[model samples]
Target: MQRRRLLQSAALALCPAACEKKRRSPLPFATLADLTSMIQAEQTTPLLLVEHFLERIAQIDRSGPRVNSILELNPEAKTIATTCKPGLLHGLPVLIKDNIETADAMQTTAGSLALRGHKPKRDAALVTRLREAGAVILGKTNLSEWANIRSPNSTSGWSARGGLTRNPHRLTHSASGSSSGSAAAVAAGLAPAAIGTETNGSIVSPASACGIVGFKPTVGLINGAGIIPITHHQDTAGPLTLTVRDAELLMQVLAENFTATPLPDILIGARLGVLRTQSGKHPQVLALFEATLQKLRDAGTIIVDLVELPNAREAGALAWKALLIELRADLNAYLEQRGGDVRSLAELIAFNEQHRDTEMPHFGQEFFAQAEQLGTPEIIAAGQEARKLAMQLAGPEGIDAALKAHDLDALICPTNDPVGLIDLKSGDTNERVASTPAAVAGYPHLTVPMGFVDGLPVGFSFIGTANDDAHILALGHHFEQLTQARRAPAFSAG
Candidate 1:
């Protein structure tokens, strides 16, 4: 067991008056057990603990890596702390992907300068559950501008309002979007945990970029209300955390239907599919994926490597098109309710045109143009065809048919390549990942840390059908316990 070491340098000790108060430990950060114990002992109130996190937010976020991934900070965090209890998460602080909303003072910018001042009128239903579970809604983290669907050239974590989010590993690599900020913050210890939504690989890809466990629940598991629009079929909020227990902790809060437990030996022995076709990730990542298969096989898992996924890329493209069309309608309706200004996507594009200095300094809204064209009858039919093909390729004919044909508990793949260079003008050029297929199916996928490459972390994704989220989470938990694959990075004291 990695005995959670406490590194209490003078730097960590440079806390606000809140963290500087008398304490047995001088450190600014604590482990999962440490946090749970602190809450259990009442040694520190949830309010004070949240204050510590906010202090860290002021200290490290955007200051160090200039990892400008956070779109906004929740101003009503203190107010949320006042209503805490013990049965639920009990005041653990968490970051929300910018696309999701809380009725806090923070503006939900979705990483675009166009909607800079839009405030969600009320908590998204999932935010309601987060509060009910006693978790502190810390703030909104930055994401790919429009969740990376706006433009293929869009930088993963570079938002006009938030700037570019730096990778925790090298400080120069891309933190894969569109859930870029959510993954970076949790890995950097900016928060104990965070929430992220996915239309494609948004959740798991970023989680892979910054070493953390990311869970995208079976579609509809977490309510999508108040989340800035994407494809409703695919988008849902899930947990990104340092440990499987923490991932389970957040999932329990978000879903009305899930219970966490380590799977039994018989369950571990269940057939597992080793996807052989995903050849896009790095060599180290492929090695890690193979290593993971070896671990499971050694434990008696019936590993099947010959499984086929002919529809993977085609389905992925379809899912992207579906997202664009859905985003147009969903966003326009969301904007209509706001009603005071910005009423349509056209207006938003116009606003960005007016402020192109901030929003388009690096890349143009080519995806927005693509989306704007989707509403036309010609493009609409093409979108319909894409949706049908996607459903056929990724859903019943792809992951489902393959998993069933092989009789597998879950399917594994390299989620994302290790950290790549951050390019604000060109965006993430070395991008490659395997989160698209499962994401398109609206199935649940859990990404646990696989291993590190060049001192950078990569992850393996375990994806399963919608309602079987618990099974995948349990399998991931087992792997996490067996391998324990994570190491905190040290700040370069140059």
Candidate 2:
């Protein structure tokens, strides 16, 4: 087994006195294990943790940087934490994305104004499972309205209910999306960890841009019964935290049967496919990626370089078509059960039009209009075919094919370019993102902090086949141990 290496860097060691104190405090930016140990040793109670987080949310999130990551907090969080039964996550606080149902005093608006007062009669299955695991539902984080499916040119992290979520690294940069708030909140030390759902790049991208750990488990590994839909084919909630082990703990709780055994030597003799095609255009990103490649080589891992996925553009088009159709059908189903003020996609569109002053001030609902028009049987059939083709292309013909051909245990690529400038006037400025293949294939993808560029952080992704969630987590954990790539956000405020 390869011995662990510590990254003894000046930046890491030169933490401010306040940060050092925070790191040692009752509610530090800590790992799940650290918190659990404190609780187990009777050093702190779950109620104390909840109150600490709630106070931090009030100080940093609502007043200081005005990160705007949270939409609402559960008033009964302390009560729930106090009376919770012991389980894996006992007494932990996890922030749920605004898109997920909580069935509490909070509303599951999915960041849409139309669902401002919508409340489900029952909690989402995942929420119920989390509660059973002793997790205190901390509150809801803001997100891109309708999970950023409302328009092609919409700004990420900008929901009508929750204005804009600023990156803690730099107040003006984008937090990515549609899991924007979840990632931002975690990065800003507003929560120990948060749950973020992804359809394509939603989870990993934000986690990547925000400089944290994001794990998108094999689709269907975690129950998606309560999450607001983007595409049932690609939606799954995962954890965003300071460390990969925290993500593993969360995955265990979320995927009830999950238990991770340490891989004695995760890197020795392992073969990893380097998806060069998906690396971003940014020069700094390329440099960081190359440095990462060198680290892997030094660790005795074989790198199969310059690999490409076939039919990339065509598969993307198909995925888009499928998303529209699935959004229409899946959303309608969710609304039927949700019994919201707006019952259908058509009503949602009309509502946006009616509230153009607030909702449409930034971008129009073009994607929603398309979804409204995509209800015909012919369109539905075409969408199903497209989804199948996209899945085949992204799965067997794409990621799976290359993995088999190269004898790779996992795949690596830049998760996204460095954080972009948040521009509401022209909408989100996206860069090269490596999420589509695993997303459409319904596989597991994990993004870990890689390095920084121009003071902003970027991440590298480790992707594996459908049931390889544990393997990916092990790889990420090993890599993190070797590099210690994650840097605490500066919380640069306006």
TM-score per candidate:
0.90, 0.94
Tens-digit per-residue lDDT, 1-494, candidate 2: 01211231342377556434543467558677888888897666786788788888989889977888998999899788778879989998899999888888998888878887768787888899889999999999999888888898999999998889989888889999999999999998888999999998899989988999999998899998888898889999889999999999888888856778699778888899888777767888999888988998999989989877666667788998899999999988888778867888888888889999988898999988888899999999999999999988888888888888888999899898876788999998877678888898899999999999888889989999888999999999999998898877887753
> Where is the poorest 10-residue window by lDDT in model 1?
1-10
For model 1, residues 277-335, the per-residue Cα lDDT tens digits are 86464677777777877887787778788678767878888777777887777778888
- Superposed by TM-score, candidate 1 places the C-alpha of residue 469 at a distance from the truth, in angstroms, of 0.3
Candidate 2: lDDT of 163? Answer: 89
RMSD of 2: 7.6
> Residue 232 CA error for candidate 2 (Å)?
0.8
lDDT score, candidate 1, position 113: 70
List the pairs of residues colliding in candidate 2. none
Cα TM-score of candidate 1: 0.90
Top-TM-score structure, candidate number = 2
Model 2 global lDDT (CA atoms, 0 to 1) = 0.87
Superposition TM-score, candidate 2 onto the true structure? 0.94
Relative to the unseen true structure, what is the C-alpha lDDT of residue 484 in candidate 1, on a scale of 0 to 100?
A: 81
Per-prediction CA RMSD (Å): 5.7, 7.6
